[model samples]
Target: MAILKHVAGKSADYGAALDYLKYEHDEVLKKPLLDANGNWVLRRDILLDGINCEPELFDVECEMLNAQYHKNQNYDEIKTHHYLISFDPADKDECGLTGERAQAIGMEYVKTNFPGHQALVCTHMDGHNGSGNIHVHIVINSLRKLDVPQKSFMERPIDCKAGYKHHLTKDYLKHLQQSLMNICMRENLNQVDLLSPSVNKITQQEYYARQRGQINLDKLNAELIAEGFTPMRTKFQTEKDKLRDSITAAAKRAKSFEEFSRQLQAESGISVKDHRGRFSYLLPNREKYISARTLGTSFDRNHLLMLFESNALTAEREKQQWSVADPIAVLYIKSNLRLVVNLQDCVKAQQSRAYAQKVKISNLQQMANTIVYIQQHGYDSYDELKKARDELSAKMSDARNTAKSTDADLKRLNEQIHYLGQYLSTKATYKEFLQANNKKIYRSEHQEEIAKYEEAAQFLKRSSPDGTIPTMKDLRAEKEKLLSTRAVQYESYAYFKDYYHELQTACQNVDMILDTGHTQQHSRTHPKRSHEPSL
Candidate 1:
């Protein structure tokens, strides 16, 4: 995936910016980013739109312009904008995109986007942490040094004068993202959702801390074990991870952004703050806040708003609600829905063997109970236990059969629903499918649409064995029934399986008692009788 990051720097000395750009940073590369020839690799550098300056003299040109025109502007005002456009590491081999191609893309991007600006474009082969992704660094002077012609949208030309600073608007940033997305798509390179936030994003400090913490933890664990102490480790949870979870939980429960913010504060004690057109989260204990944009794409203010707004407006109302028929089944239904293991079942499994060892009943009582249980039916010793096990197994087999049937029914229903949904969704194209005079011409024009509709029709025909296609309402109703049946059958299957396993375990215990020396004890007790009647 491609990542676009912008870092704006300001300094009275333009040389500082140039030095920072050219010099090797310990974070970015272990050694200086060298070319294939092994000299200091500034070979990929290109100076754009500067007549008097080469790549090396680009900083001097910027300084000269600043001294001439923007002398009154604050020394601390942003004089340089550094942009990092990194491609997917795999794209180099997969898409055959070279460092030179990346450099060209960067140059063209700057030329098209920041016209009349003096910019230094350089491509680096090494990424931070040996990532090996081809990334470009474009450092453009804040001042527009050439006159830019006014577009049709503008009323007047923009002249290069004192304080002719470029405005980095939100739209401009969005345009950069869109441009990057288009470039990747055109090259058939792997691309990420440019508009979406990444799931896991850590700061440089957190990244280094995590790396160090892992090493320290391992060392500490070893030392603790040597001292015969309990080895413990601290789990690191960043503010972003905490906020992401809190926000997601809040989103599920809250309808609106206002409610989401309130719920988030209630849940995690992090209050939402929007100041000067930026979204930040205020930690309860911290005076300074961190930007939401820094956290990840999903936590961005606009994205969050869109998500919560959609939930409030449409999704929440459209969601289906299912109910358990039996009150006790509610627990099972919830366990299934959450995909959580049953704690009671886990505890029972752990304590199962203890049942054999800890039984307080005397042998006499056990014998009496076993005799009574056997007497209720025609049962004898091992045969009785085996018979009981077989009955339980049979019931389990039946339950499993029902469950399998339910699954098949659900699968068919789902496929029907999917095809029906596709047909409904692509109705506009299907209309064109029907209206086409020349079939070949229509297929050529609306190839994708025609293919989608044809696939759906074929599936529908195959599914409708009775030669009547199912209506959406009919399919929906059938789906609801199948889902309901699936839940019931699944629960029954679990219950029968557990019961059968208990029977199996009990039978195995009985077998252990019968096969061990306990059986010899009975034989020894009846030694006086040469022949004993089988019970």
Candidate 2:
């Protein structure tokens, strides 16, 4: 994918930034190539139109412009703005774009977007870690040298002579991104949709850590194996991954922003801080925080607000429906409260009109009788209803755990059976491999087969004290035995599945009974009195 990386930084000394780009010193290099003092290697360097300087005189020309036109005399003040525009590395050979062609694209980009600025648009061939991605460095003097056309900055007319400074905004950045995409498309080069929804944006810190092979779990597992210790499952999920999954799940389940935020904190132990208009998630253990946009598009500030608005509209419509809904219809919906909470169930319920009608008919008759029973016995208090729901939820949780455990056992057993079968099938190949061990020559095609059998044999030896290799007949018998046991185990596990469904239905029934035709309020003061009817 063609990633448009935009890094903007102000520097008092423009030459330093220019030198860093041209010098080619990075962690990937075995030795820093800074021996050449002033003469740095550059693939292509060109000054834009109106910049009266050759590529060779880049430093002197920029210094002169800063000294003459720039009003701020302070040496520390930012006199130059640097930007990076890059493309995917594979584009070079794939798109047939030479270094000169890439430079032309960069030059055109600067001329089109950053007009009226004395800019040195330089294209570099050696990317980070020798990735070979052709990237452009657009170093422009902050002081404008010509009248920027109204088309470039539509908000206000730029008069370079009147000391008007160039301004960049989010919208302008997006516009420039679009222009780059267009340029790539027009020139028949490799391109990516820069405007696509950015779900996961990896930061520089994570990128460098991965490059350095500093991630712990992977290294730990390899070390454990090397030391003859069986490596257990490594909990490799970082705090960020957990937080992202939690937020994404909550966002999907929550009906409103308030509910999403509340559920996210309650479930994930991550507190949300909304300062000014930006949103950030603060991890409990870490002082560092991540922005909402950094998480994904679904968690963006604007998107969350839009979701809140949408949910509010939905609630309003539901409230209106509740006011005039038929008693049977209300009862039917109340009986399916579990469906309301489960997106998958709700989708299944809406899959077909006939199935939905069938559900309604079933709920209506049962609910009609339940409503009569509730009227005769008086309503169940909020606390009583909540207790019943909680009890059912507990049962469902236990049942789900049991099912998951059984499924895991089945999977492990199946994997073992498969490995044993493979080992038995490759016995002949293993004998051949043993003979080839001392031989000077062996067939290359048989190496893969030999390796697989060898790995299985070693694993089997580690598992068994005598290193017993099961015969094909024995392996088949064991597999058949496991299949038979699985059938019986599955039959037993069917009860938990049924139990979960029954508990969900019961919980939904209780919610239906409590939520309909009642204004129940909850309070901490006088528990019994608090549960009294609000109607």
Candidate 3:
């Protein structure tokens, strides 16, 4: 995950920011909250507010602030924070930990390492990355207590040190790193060093310039051309002939060292040996040997010379151009369409299972109620009641299976939807390519197909008797209805089952109680006869 740090306030020093960032790291309960772009965005401001509030008052005050912000902005208040450390979720594993959990872990780590400082940790999950990564945001409060003296906020604050102005210094950054390292060591987590921030160091142009200087494009093109081969610029290719022409032109322009060699090999069947004992196509009548630098490429003569001597260039080029017009593109498009289909299938499966679960739960509830009614009528020991209890138990097991199957179907449906989303995103370019090639035909076909599938999927999305996808409240109502039905069935089964067991236990107890009472009565009536016993 990529980690980013930003400082707030015009006069903010690195030290103060670092201290605040560290404190925020410790105080926030969840890590890496996702933003609209699906990147992890953590705010330091909310963390600082959380830390400054009394422990008992933190949650309530935060909730009120959040509520007020939402009422005004319709979004979370944390987005308004001045300082933030954002993380990219593409770098993380699929543990499904939410932003809250990330914040909690980060905060706990900081609290254990740094004693008195207050911090807010925000964690986020971002789906924007090619590989989803989880990121954490740690925000710390820069200002220390005004009344506190001598001791830095890094140490435990005494009762007398309630209102001191604590300023963060550059040295505090060092302390922050040490604390983070300590936590990492204790927890066996990966350690990162932010002492020298890498983001602000270089410009993109400078990096590109350096990269361009390392490649000898001119020499490579010439060599390929001389071997009766052409350099194809796959990026701009529209047709096969165009690709062939582009390669032919580069071969004919044999002015540089590489180009001359390439042309000579194409024209004359001559091969020559270099100083390094590498074989290259030699000039027909020229006595002097040409080095790669004569072509003005920026590599060492030996390295440039090696290209002509090697056969691996063709293989590498082929690999690079593999996806330019391959069948894989078509296959990917088909796969994406299949995914859309699968999602429809899943929705249907989930709907069917949900209905089945509702029915089974209802049946179980009814059976439970029936058993309870029988026991209540003083027919507790009836043989028919025992048989009904056993039958109901068997039915209940079937209902449980139905519920489990419904959960599985729902999970599958969700997974299919997620996969379809990913497939659409990844193959977006291919779809565009197809449209560009056959605009009217492809559009008409895709539009019709998509419309049909959407209609079918919509049916499964319905959550009410009106055949509409229900809102949260509507869904809840449906759930309650099913649950209420199930509850009644369960009550009947439980009542009868419990009654049957109770009767058996009572019968045994009664037999013992009567025997003891009879013996006691006999003893009272005739003491000698009681001892002698009437066989």
Q: Which candidate tops TM-score?
A: 2
lDDT of 3 by residue, 378-487 (tens): 45554654454455455456556555655554554554444344433434543453447776765575665444444433443442234333233223333443554556
lDDT per residue for candidate 2 within 459-502, as digits (tens), equals: 76565445554444444444554555656556544544454454
User: Model 1, poorest ten-residue lDDT window?
Assistant: 331-340
Estimate the lDDT of model 1. Answer: 0.66
Of 1 and 3, the candidate ahead on lDDT is 1
Per-residue alpha-carbon lDDT of candidate 1 for residues 195-260, written as tens digits (9 for 90 to 100): 755655676566666565556777866864674434433454455556667667777756676887
**Model 1: runs farther than 4 Å from truth?**
28-52, 151-163, 193-237, 245-282, 287-535
TM-score of 2: 0.48
Summed over model 2, clashes come to 0
Question: Candidate 1: which pairs clash?
Answer: 197-297
After superposing all C-alphas onto the true structure, candidate 2 shows an RMSD in angstroms of 19.9
- Candidate 2 global lDDT: 0.61
Answer with 1 or 3, whichever has the higher TM-score. Answer: 1
Cα lDDT for residue 378, candidate 2: 39
